[model samples]
Target: MSPYLKLLFYLSGISFAVSFEIDYSNPDVVEYDSNSQIEKTEKVDLRVYYCSFCGGCVYFHTKQLDPTLKKIGSYIDLKNYPYGLTTRYKKHGKIYFDCAHGPAECHGNKLHACAIDILKNTTQSEFYNSCMMNSTWGGEGSSDKDAINCGKLMRIDSKPIIECANSERGDAIMEYYGIETDKVTNPKNKHMPLILLNGKEFNRAKDLMKTICQTLTKPPPECKSYF
Candidate 1:
């Protein structure tokens, strides 16, 4: 990994460790002891591997996942990777990329990666992402411009994000996301926006609330029905 990639991993690693995990490996998969074993609070690790321009991915995140986080945000440690099904290669001393949805998607994916790196907080970055995704919800916004507008709306400085997304650092981060996405074998990554809860495949979107509710040793009040 290049220096930038290492830095991105380092940043994410620090945040992950603060969440009360015992064993951490791939960004996509991590295991933790039940909160009972640890005096400090433990969090369920949530990982989502997605591509930015996939309509289904966008809808799931912006429409479904965002709302779900509102209730379980405190109980979860979420990591969102944005290069699903994208490939990269070095050509003529420059790194190039091929994405599932073409160049536009690749650009969007890189933009997402940049946002993650610059913001350094998945939830905060996701808000930025939700903005960009929703801006293009009707297929109307350019990736770069949407990022800036989202940043403005969210009161974030998007200048660095723009520079990183258009630079080699962006390519490096995208590559990092690709490597992380490859570690997802449980659901076999059959599709983008593949969800992993506590290192297991979680396919039931409707049961998301209940699942998280039941997973935690002490379920939250929002999951009252599950009690």
Candidate 2:
């Protein structure tokens, strides 16, 4: 080939290589918002306290864990939460621990779509506005839908006292009632929310319901006691 022709071919090859590298490094076809003012300025570390199996919970946890530390501006460090999304005990599958990756992980892309929308520009008030919390027995289907709808409706109502006091799942029943948290103080026991008050004359569930009722202009009628 002639000198000019050879030079043209060489430059074409170089151009192709550069273009390929650029595409490979940044695979996302759509570009994110480029405005620096609205972009997160710094990364902040957040210790997540909820189950990793729930996408909504994980979404909040990730957003709170500012990504700027890695120069990425608000991202999560999966390596940190070893007991992530799938650490439930073998004997008692109802309880789940924590984990970082995999489809089973709480933050799997499927469940967090709505949450992601809220996270982008919605505030805490907005988030709560879209939730619905119910307290009942023998409900069909899963809590995932309830969590989603409750999030959409922004209402949280725990189980009645009777359910809380008598349910076979003691910790779950208490959590639903907002009266007590499972004790994790003992090393032998898995991590669970701490129960603040003893289940005596001071009914934590009733107090929480009262607080909720007071907060809204129109709250639910007097809370029904389980006992």
Candidate 3:
């Protein structure tokens, strides 16, 4: 791996050790005698993968870092932070994605855990912070009304994809948001697909959130849950 990746892994290991609290339930009572064992696992994993593959990792990295940086913190505030975390990149500025792929290159892969973590850890301040950033990434309202607006925007942005959802319940929700399934082209006249879906139509923002939620459906709850 590259040096950057290595560094990230090292930092991840140290942070994980200091940050995460181990939970050894009855099933693993005999595995180790103390939390130190758990901390060891975290360090090794961070070294081996350079990543926890958890959204909480993103939570700490983004929220605890500098605000001017490109992390979720720069765009969001601590109050908007999801449930599992403690801060929102409060001290540092934006940093790059640190994943193999860089930021501004999102293809719905690296961001899943991060976003879900934030949603779960959200506070009123973070909510308002998100709203002002663009009101698109779980910011501002996020209620049914805001969801409708987001749905409308998503539909307008992904016409063909949204239409493919045609008879899906998700599509029905999108319609309720006042976003009709149709084609839209920017000034460049390029075709734009509205709505995003893993398999079916995404009628509401929450519908799309299902995909984000999938990233956290694992053990140790790598990415904390807000809902």
Candidate 4:
């Protein structure tokens, strides 16, 4: 097993099992509008699955895309899913997740999910960027307070997100993401961030923009400028 998966097993103290199965035939994808309002004649779907506390994920996927997003935003509909790199366990007859970066990261994931629920697409993007800016990989980077702080920085009311983070809804979303991660076949891969463009996995973070540009059937003006 990979070090990450080993860590998971160590934390959970349970053998890996397919606890449940989901309909992988249809994956959840969310479409977002660009920062610009320019109507595009052609568009492609871009999906990113990420763990907030993964340093590599934050550095390569979140921080690196801000500039590229400005150019390709209109040509691509971006959807980001927060995948928690955590293990599930039963404690006192209650199930709990042990996040790699601790409870703060888990809380941050819930915050992001709640933001998606209450904020507009553009706002969601902004909120994600802000939260990521506060994140650290492989450790307890951003705390629950930091998540709320980021929301406030974006002028988003943090109450709803905080409430959601503390509710059963938050637990369900995290569990759902855990299931999604399991769908990936790589035995060594136990963490985030994973990217998929139109149902195809894009493994390398450095090649993300190039891959997206190449995947576009009807190349936008931005594609020409990108390459």
Q: Which of the predicted structures, 3 or 4, would earn the higher lDDT when compared with the native? A: 4
**Which window of 10 residues has the lowest lDDT sum in candidate 4?**
18-27
lDDT score at residue 32, model 3, on the 0-100 scale: 23
Error of 1 at 209 (Å): 1.7
Candidate 2, superposed: residue stretches over 4 Å from native: 1-43, 52-85, 88-142, 151-227
lDDT of 4 by residue, 56-175 (tens): 765654344544564566666666667546677767866578777777777767666666655667525533444433432223434556555445444557677678778887777667
Q: What lDDT, from 0 to 1, does candidate 1 have?
A: 0.69
Query: Could you tell me which residue pairs clash in candidate 4?
Result: 55-137
Q: Give the alpha carbon lDDT tens digit for every residue of 1-227 in model 1.
A: 65334323533434532121111122222122122233455578888888887777776775566656655566777888898787789999888889988998888888889988887766667767766765432353338777776665566788899889889999999988888887774454568778888888788456677778888888777878888
Q: Estimate each model's TM-score.
A: 0.77, 0.22, 0.16, 0.69
What does each candidate score in C-alpha RMSD? Answer: 11.8, 22.3, 21.3, 13.0
Clashes of each: 0, 25, 37, 1
- How far off is residue 169 in model 3, in Å? 38
TM-score of 4: 0.69
lDDT-sorted candidate list, best first:
1, 4, 2, 3
**lDDT, each prediction:** 0.69, 0.27, 0.24, 0.57
Whole-model alpha-carbon lDDT for candidate 3? 0.24
Better of 1 and 2 by TM-score: 1
Model 1 TM: 0.77
Error of 1 at 143 (Å): 0.7
Q: Model 3, 1-227: lDDT tens per residue?
A: 64334323433434532332211111121222212323332210100001112232233322322121121111112211111101112125432222222321111211222322322432221222222122222322223333333334222222332233232333223222211112221244211112223323223323222333342233133224435
